[model samples]
Target: MPTTTQLVISGQSKPGVMAQVASVLASAGVNIKAFSAPEVTGTGKLRLLVADLEGARAALRGAKIRFAEETALVLSLENKPGALNEVADLLTQARINIKCGYCTPSREGKRAIVVLTVSNTEKALSVLRDQSLDEF
Candidate 1:
């Protein structure tokens, strides 16, 4: 099963803030698993997936950065065409609305890891799990 890990970078509300943050991660060779910017003002939030979450967090803090954290659902599905359509169909049928989602392929497989940010997390998890096709 895949697990979603959220890294909350201090708000980068100002333009160019995200670039600075991304530069730091890029310099560290951290692969971004998933990314999101909160709509809050002043402080910006960035959620990332790195090869090493602890190490990344430590590095950021060593640089005197602030961040928050959370666990999300990360699932991998077939990369073939229409794969997403199937998932969407299922969710729609279940009356689940996906607020946001991002996808990236695994380095070693023909599967894409999708991080879904939804309102009804627990219910979504249940539905996905019941389908025997998702891992969170």
Candidate 2:
């Protein structure tokens, strides 16, 4: 697990918007580690965790895309029932607040990459240490 930057982009919820963002990053050789795009009322809020933060930023800037950045905690958890529950319980016990989260699993579904923005990231990481809920 590690701390990384997450880019949040808000844009019109229409066809080709996703393609436009993905293409810019792809052209810059930035790999999307985890991504979520949920649209509401014709607007989409996209969150992305990419391998190359600087490259992603550059690409988005070159494309004139407006985005905001945040510090996020990244975790690798087992891909199975109750996996998230364990983490949530641990955090709850530690009194750490989870602001928002998203996850993606491996191709074979063996493990998941969880991205979280928490109320106290430092405490969250420390509290998570030595917990079985996290694989890394």
- Candidate 2: regions farther than 4 A off: 130-134
lDDT of 1 by residue, 1-136 (tens): 4556677676648888777777777777676656877677766567777777877787777666788776666878887899888877877888888876778888887888887766666777777778887543
TM-score of 2: 0.85
Count of clashing residue pairs in every prediction: 3, 0
The global Cα lDDT (0 to 1) of model 2 is 0.87
The candidate maximizing TM-score is 2
**How far does residue 95 in candidate 2 sit from its true spot (Å)?**
3.4
Model 1 ranges off by over 4 Å: 13-15, 26-31, 34-45
Worst 10 residues of 1 by lDDT: 1-10
